[model samples]
Structure formats: structure tokens, C-alpha cells
Target chain A: MRATVIHAPFDVRLEELPDPRIEGPGDAVVKVVASCICGSDLWPYRGDPPVKQPRPIGHEFVGIVQEVGFDVRTVKPGDFVVAPFVVSDGTCPHCLAGYQTACQNLVGYGQGKADGGQGEYVKLPYADGTLVATPEVPDDALVPSLLTLSDVMGTGWHAARSARVKAGDTVVVVGDGAVGLCGVLAASRMGAERVVALSRHEPRQKLAKEFGATDIISERGDAAKDAVLELTKGVGADAVLECVGTAQSMTTAFDVARPGATVGFVGVPHGVEVPISTMFRNNIGLAGGAAPCRAYLPALMADVLSGAIDPGKVFDSELPLADVAEGYAAMHERRAIKVLLRP
Target chain B: MRATVIHAPFDVRLEELPDPRIEGPGDAVVKVVASCICGSDLWPYRGDPPVKQPRPIGHEFVGIVQEVGFDVRTVKPGDFVVAPFVVSDGTCPHCLAGYQTACQNLVGYGQGKADGGQGEYVKLPYADGTLVATPEVPDDALVPSLLTLSDVMGTGWHAARSARVKAGDTVVVVGDGAVGLCGVLAASRMGAERVVALSRHEPRQKLAKEFGATDIISERGDAAKDAVLELTKGVGADAVLECVGTAQSMTTAFDVARPGATVGFVGVPHGVEVPISTMFRNNIGLAGGAAPCRAYLPALMADVLSGAIDPGKVFDSELPLADVAEGYAAMHERRAIKVLLRP
Candidate 1:
């Protein structure tokens, strides 16, 4: 089997790996049909938090179940399934409470407990809990959108949900990445009257507009905040989605939120400092993190299949599994918003 | 007239000051009927952030409106009123949005814009916005509870509201101060199935029990977190109230919160660092800040007026207005949970 591995910074490679087999009673072997590079993957790749050792990488994918252990009841061999970025035991307290990302018995793809999603096949535990099957395998054209249900789309939806976006709200999205673009779509679909996207990139801005961003601001930092405040006539945004996890992004997210509004943050924080005084003084709240994608997969998958949304447009570049390194490079170089890989 | 002023650490004195009179169209003069020492007052008294100069200090008081300017419409002379900790123009977007603390024209008591609450009289602007007048002046026994509405009781209610305390929740309160004790009351009123108070002090624990605490854990730090988890059979509390502004208190607040729970914090953060990674991993949320006390005043005042809640029990000591110095000392020395001063 061929899989992706990162030996060091700037060195992701497709390497031959032994075939994965179901090792637990609740495990299933999945033959990945599609996978992709993520902005978070760039963190380790760029040495922000450098890789310590060579390891399997990639956590988002859609696949066909090739084999299933006896205990697997929700999914079966030959079922088309979408796997959330993390696996969880279905009946754990947190999972039962709809926060599978914090499940007591949680497993991450690419870690030793589960095969990397960027491989030909993945053997994973908790099949009933982790995988969601489409009603039927749809046309090949729907693969990209369904594959997104594995992480980004659900994550974007989580940001909107966490921010408590509602009808007639003015929402601000503070990043232009695929997830941020999807957040614009989520807020708009949630009935927000105005969706504001902060983006400097022309391509990403175009996608943002298509994703239902009623306004776009090509500014950064304080200027971006000023633009948002100006757009809303100094009232600020009713809900803010902090999609980029940086100190500056987080600051702007808080700065542009109206009094009593919440900043729903889904980005993995990197050198971020929450402005406690600002949040306190303005009565603004901060919520959301490491979105529970599994909890959102069912409804989001339905949205994708029904053509209510087309988040697959976030994939501006595509590559074969063998060219995964180029896909990583293109994304890192900012040449692609997101890159989808076919196995 | 006499006013309380803080010249330095451990030095609070009631000294002669000019009598206050309305100077703005929206202004009103409030004759101090009752004022109280707050935990926040001890901040400048002990001088964590050292007081720069001698300044008037108190912000919580119940009073009778002495006079009102021509523009004052909601309150008038001879009316018994409860003044919120801060003065805000009621017509601002934030104020209209039910977040008076973040009102565009916000004025803090003792900040020169308004006379210190611990004074013979307070001349403040935005009378219609900041002062809530009762239908009629009630008996002296109701004075203490009504005074609490100016700050602590409303702050506690804000914490519960920010945490989104719903029916059937298991709530945890992280501080044993007046605000936290009031939070127990707030959570109970909101229909939490269980209200847990982390208090080691016997007096506070007793008050907590009276205020609707179903469980009391006199543990600190990790032990406290462990105790809460054990109480919930390892599931953690559904909502947590962080009423101590220290780093340790904030940490424990997050530690005891179950995944998907919100930690509603109302203490003024002094040296707090948010646990972003922990919040991200568990999907825990942090909300609430310098509570919009004015917004909550009307409802909480009704609760107090009806004798449904007696938050005034938190005041363990009382002093004449001239002995305001002793009130500060008693509160600072931990000899008094809270001290009420009669002017």
C-alpha cells in the first residue's frame, strides 16, 4: 500500500507501506477514494512545531469500506463512508453529549492507533462511531464535497454554530482559508443577513463572495477592524468567526465583535493570546475549538448531497495520491486554497 | 459632605467633600442611603494595581434621588433608586442590545464623571439609563438586598446568563465570595438540578447552602477539580461560574467544566491566563465578563424585592458612613464577607 509520511520539515513523501487490516472487534478497513491537505498539516510541515520523527499524515478522507469486524453494525463492507478527522467511542459521555472530539477513548488518523487517511487503505477502531455512510454512493462529481464533510465543512459549520449565528445577524469571518470560506457559506445558510469575509487574496475573496459573503475587506489588523466597524455603522459584527488561529487574527476577531457578541474560534491557536480585558469589558464571549466534526457529519453530508451548498469549490487544485508532495507545496506556497488528492 | 477616598495601600478615609448637584441635562443627584464594600474595592485598597492618587472609591449603593435635571425622565427626586455600578446612556446600541456595561457613553462611579458611591451624594449623568427606581420606597430591612442589585447579585446573574444556565444542569461555582455565593442563587433560580460551591470557609459555605448550593467541596486546585468530577460521576459540571479572578481560579473553573460546558467568569481578571489548548481540546467555552449589571438590575431587583432571594446576608458587618475606613479594613482582613455602610 502507498501512504503519506513526513520525515522532516518540507519533506512529505508518498511511500510504500504494509497493508492495513482490521485489528479490533470494532475496527474496519477502508479503501480511501479521496483525501486532502489541510492548513493544520502545514503547521508541522513548516516546522512551526517541527516534526520530531517520520510519521503517517492526513486525517480527512472519504472511502469505501473494504472489510469490517464482526462488531461493526452501522457500516458494512462495500458501504461508501466519510470519516471524521478523529475517531471516538460512540457511547462515551462526551460523545453522547455531542462532543466526540473530546471522547474519552478518542483516536486520531495518522497516529499509531489509526492508518493515515492519505493512504490506499485505513484500518480504524470504533467503526460505528467514526464513519458516516451516504445513502448511496453518488456521482463522482460529488466526491470533493462529500470528502469535505470529513472535516472542513463540518468545522466551518461548528464555527457558525459555536458563535450562535442566527437569522438577521451580521457575521464576520476573519480568515480567507478554505474553512473561513466555508464559514461564510455556513453563516449565510444559517440566515445571517450579512456575511463579512476578511481576505487579501483575490482568488480566495472571489470564492468567499460565491460562498455568500455579502461584503469583503482586503485589510488587515486594526484597519480591518475599522472596515468592519464602518461597514456595520460602528455597531461591529453580531458574531465573529476567528478562522485563523494567530494572535493578530484573534485580536481582530474580538475587536470587531459588537458588545454581547461571541467570537467562535475554530483555528488551532499558534502564539495566540486571548484578550481577557476586552472580552470582559465588552461582555463579548469566546467559544469553539477543535470542532466536533463527527457530530456535524450527518446533517452536513445531507446538505452536500442535496446541493444546498457546494463547499467543494474550496478545492482550487487537485492532484493524484502519488503527487501528494506537490499538493502540500502548492498549498504551503499559497498557490492553492485547498488541494484534493485522488487515490 | 463626606466621601471615602483611598490615599494609598491600606488607607481608606471618609473626609469632607463638596456636596454634589446635577450639572448635565441627563444628570441626577442621588443621596447615598446605603453603600457597601466590594471585593473589587480591596484591589485598590491592597493595591495590586497600586492606586496612583487619592480617589473616591465605592461603586455599589442604594439611594434616594435627591434631584433630577430637566431631561431626566425615568427617575425623579424623592424616588428610591438602585444605581448600577456604571452609568450608561440608555439609548446607545449596546445599551439597547441589553449590554449596558458596554454602552458607548459609559461612566464609572468614582471616576470623576460620577461621584463615588461611598459619599454623601452622587451626581451622575445618564440618570434615566443608570438608575432603576422602585415603585415606592420599601422598609429598611429590604435595603441590604436592594443594595446588592447595584453589583454582586446582578454580576452573579450575569455569570449564569452568560454560561447559558438551563434547566436540569449541574452547575459549579469556583469562588466563595459574595458574587460566587450569589451565583449559586442565580443557578438555582435558573433551575439547575445541582449547584456546587467550592468554598473552604465555614461562614461562606453556610451562606452558600442557604443560597441553594446542593453540594459543597472545600477543596482547592487539583483536589477541587477532582472533587467536582467525582460529584458528577466523572462527567464534570454542565456550567461553571468563575468568580475569583486569579490564574488558579480560572484554571480550576475550566478543569471542572465538562466538554460543551461554558465557564461564565465575572470577577475582574487580575493575572488570569486562559487555557486555550485545554478549551480547544475539550470544546469548553469561556464567556462572561464585567457583567452588564444595569441590564440585569430590573429582574434581579424584582427577585430581591419579592424576598425570593436575600443576597444581603452576604454582608456580615455594618458600619456608619464615617467609619468607612474600618469597613475596608474588615473586608480586607477577611473578617467580613462584605460590609454595608449607612450614610
Candidate 2:
């Protein structure tokens, strides 16, 4: 088997490794059919938080169950399944409450116990709790969309849900990454009358529009806030989805929210300082965090299969698993919105 | 007219002032029947944010409408009304959305346009928007409860509402002041099965228990968090009301919130730094701010009038209007939970 490993900054390689095998009663081996590079992977790749040692690296993927332990009842070999970024016991109090990301017995993909997702095969625990199977393996064309349920699509949906986006809301989506684009789609699908996307790049803006962004602001910082306020006729957005976790993006998200509106942020924060005074004075709320993707997989998977949404468009570049390094490079350089890899 | 004025820290005086009169089409002059010294008033009294000059203070009061501009419709002369801490037009988008605190034409009491509430008479704009009148004058005993509706009760209700307290939830309140005590009542009224109060003061603990705190944890800081976690079987409280705005209180509020739980904070934040990373990793959400008390006035008012709640017990000390300085001193020295004043 071969897996993606990060040796140091800007150094991701597909290296040969021993094949994975189910090691626990709740474990299963998945033959990776599809995976992709994520923006977070860039955090270490760019040395923002430099890698300390060589380790397996991906956490999103969809594949066929190649083998399953005796205790795995929900899925079996030959079943197509989507694995959320993290594995949970599903029976823990948090998981039972629909927050699998905070599961008491949680396991992260590529973190020793579970094989890295961007690999030929992944042996992971808590199979029954983490993997969601499609009703039936559908046409190959639906793979990309289903693949997204592993993280980005569900994460985007979580942002919209967290912001409490409702049918007549004017929603502002900050960030034009794959997740933000999906957020635009999620808000629109949730019946938001107006979905605003803030993006400076032409390609991302076009994609954002395609994802149902009713308006696009190419400005950054205060100017972007002004544009959103202008678009909403000085009322600001009813709900704001902050998909990029940076100080600037968070600030913009809070600034453009209307009084009493909530900013649902999903981006992993880095140097982000929440404006407590501003939020209090404006009666604004901040919600959303690491999305519980597993909790959303079933419904989102149904939406993908039913063609109610087509989030696969977020992947503008595709590569063979062997060209994984190029995929990482393309994403790091902003040459690709998201790169899909075929195993 | 005589009003409470702050000349400097530890220097509150009751000085003779000119009688107030309706100054705008929407203005109303109310003859205050009862007013209270708030926790926030102590902010300036203690010089955390030093008083710059002699200025009328106090923003919580219930009064009889003495005079109204021709355009004032909802309230008229002789009508008993409860005034929210701030004045709003009640017609702006934010106001119409039920966030009167953020009204486009918001006017705070003691700020030029609206006369300070502790004064014998208050001339305020946007009468219809800021005043909620009772059906008719009732027994004087109801005066205390009704007066609380002006701020603390409504603000406490806002915290529970903001925290999204639901039936059967285990709610934790982090402050034991008037507002936090009210929060205990609010959560219990909302059907929270377990209402926990983190209080060390014996007087407040008794008041809190009377207000429906099912459990009392007198520990502070880390011990408090451990107590709450232990009580919830390490799952944390389903909802947390952050009634005190200090950094330590805010930190504790986040620490004891269960995954997927919301921390509804209403205390005016002071030097509070939000733990964004912890929130993101645990899926704990931070919501609620200054609290749009006006929006909640109607329902809570109805509850008070019906004897469904008794928040006025929070006023542990009473003083005549002429003793305003002593009232401020008592509150500043923590000799009073809240001080009620009679004109």
C-alpha cells in the first residue's frame, strides 16, 4: 500500500507502506476510492505550525469497505462509505447529542490508530459509528459529491446551521475556499433569499456565483464590510458564515453582521481575537466550531444522491493518487480551489 | 427636581436639578415611583472607568407618566410604565427585529437626550419604544418586581434566552448578582431540570436557591469547573448563562459548557478574551450579549404581573431619594445586593 506522509514544510510524498488490516472489533479496512487536499493541511505544509516528524496526513475520503470486524454491523465489505474527518464512538454523551467531533473516545484519521485517508487503504476503529453508507453504490459520477460529505460539504452545512440561516435571511459567506463555496450552496439551499460571497480572485468569485452567491464583493477588510452593508441596504447580513479562520476574516464576519445576527464560524482560528465589546454592544452572537460532520453525513449524502445539490464543482483540479505532491503544491499556490485525488 | 449625580469615584450626590419636560414629539416625562442602583453603576463609582464630571446616573426605574408629547401614543399621562435602560426609536430595522438595544437612534439614560432614571422626573424620547406600561396601577408590593422588569429581570431573561435554555436542560449560572439570581429563576422557569449557581456569598446563595437553583457550587475558578463537570458526569452543563462579564467568569462559562452547548453571556464584558480555540475544538458556542431587554419586556412583564415570578427580592436594601449617596456607597461596598430608592 501507499500513503501520503508529511516529512517537513512543503514536503508531502506518496510513500509505499504496509497494507492496513482491521485491528479491533469495531474496526474496518476501507480501500480508498477518493480523497483530496485540504486548506488546513497547508498550515503545516507552509510551516505555520511546522511538522515535527514524518507522519500520515489526510483526514477525508470516501471508499469501499474492503473488510470489517465482527462488531461492525452498519457496514460490510463491498459497501460504499464516507468517513468523517474524525472517528467517534457514537455512543458517547457528546456523540449521542450530535457532536461527534467532541466524542469522549474520538480518533483522528492518520493519527496512528487510523490509517491516513489519502492512501490505498485505511484501517480505522468505531466503523459503525463513523462511516455512513450510501443506500447503494451509485454511478461513478456521484463520487466527488459523496466524497465531500467526509468534510467540506458537511462543514459548510454546519456553518449555515450554526448561523441559523433561515428562509428569508440575507446571508454573508466570508472566504472563497471549497468550504465557503459550499456554504454559499448550503445557505441558498436553506432558503436564504440572498447569499453574499466575499472573494477577490476571479476564478473563486465565478465559482462562488455558480454555488448560488447572489452577490460578490471583491474587496477585503473594511471595504468588504461596506460592500455587504451596501448590498443589504445598510442592514448587514442576517447570518454570517465565516469559513476562513484568520483574525481578519473573523473581524470582517462580525463587522458585517446585523444587530442580533450570529456569525457561524467554522475555520480553525489562528491569531483570531473575538471582539467581545463589539459583539456585546451590537447584541451579535458567535457560534459554530469544528463541525460534527458525522452527524450531518446521512442527510447530506441523501442530498448529493438526490441531485438537490452538486458540491463536486468545488474540485476544479483532479489528480492521480501518484501525483499527490503536485496536488498539494497546486493547492498551496492557490492554483486549485480543491484538488480531488483518484486512488 | 433632585437626581443622583456622580462627581467622581466614591462621590455620588443628590443635587437639585431643573424639572424635565417633553423635548420631542416622541418624548414623555415620567415621575419616577421607584428606581434601583445597578451593578453597572458601581463601575463608575469604583473608578474602573472613572467619571469625568458631574453627571446624573441610574437607568433602572418604574414610574407614572407625568406628561407626553402629542406624538407619544403608547404611553400617556398617569399611566404606569417600566422603562428599559436605554431609549430606542423602536422603528429602525434593528428595533423592528427586536434588538432595541442596537436601535439606530439609540439613546442611553443619563446621555443628554434622556433624563437619568434616578431623577424625580425623566424626560425621554421614543416613549412608545422604550416604555412598557402595566394594565393599571396595582398594590405597592408589586412595585419592586415591576421595577426589576426595567433591567435586571429582563437582562437575566435575555441571558437564558440567549443561551437557548430549553426544557429539561441542566443550566449553569456563573454569577450570583441580581441579574445572575434572576438568571436562575429564568432558567428554572424555562423548565431547566437542574439550575446550578456558582456562588460563595451566603446571602446570594440563599437568594439563588429561592430563585430555583437546584444545586449550589460555592467554589471559584478551576474548582468550580470541576464541580460542574462532576455534577454533569463530566459532560458539562447543557446551557451556561454568563451573567458576570469579567475575564475569569467568561472563562469559567466556556469551561463548563457541554459540547454543542451555548454560553449565553449578558454581563457587559470587561477585559474578556474569548477562548476561540477551545470553543472551536469542543464545538462550544458563545452567544448573547448586552441583551435586548425591550424585546423580552412583554412576556416577562406578563409573568411578573401574574405572580409567576418574584425577581424583585433581589433588592436587599432600600433608601429614600435624598439618601442616594449612601445607596451608591452601600452598593459599592457590597453591603447591598441591589438598592431600591423611593422618591
- Residues A160-264 of candidate 2 have per-residue lDDT tens digits of 999999999999999999999999999999999999999989998998888899899999999998898888889999999999999999999999999999999
Q: What class would a CAPRI assessor give candidate 1's docking?
A: high
For candidate 1, lDDT tens digit of each residue in A1-343?
A: 9999998999999999999988889999999999999999999999878898999999999989999989999999989999999999989999999999999999988889899888899999999999999989888999999988888999999999999999999999999999999999999999999999999999999999999999999999889989998999999999999999999999999999999999999999988999999989888899999888899888888898999999999999989999999999999999999999998
Best by DockQ: 2
Q: Give model 1's TM-score for chain A to 2 decimal places.
A: 0.99
Q: Worst ten-residue run, lDDT, model 2 chain A?
A: A44-53
- Give the interface RMSD of each candidate: 0.6, 0.7
Backbone clash pairs for candidate 2 read none
| Candidate number achieving the greatest TM-score relative to the actual structure | 2
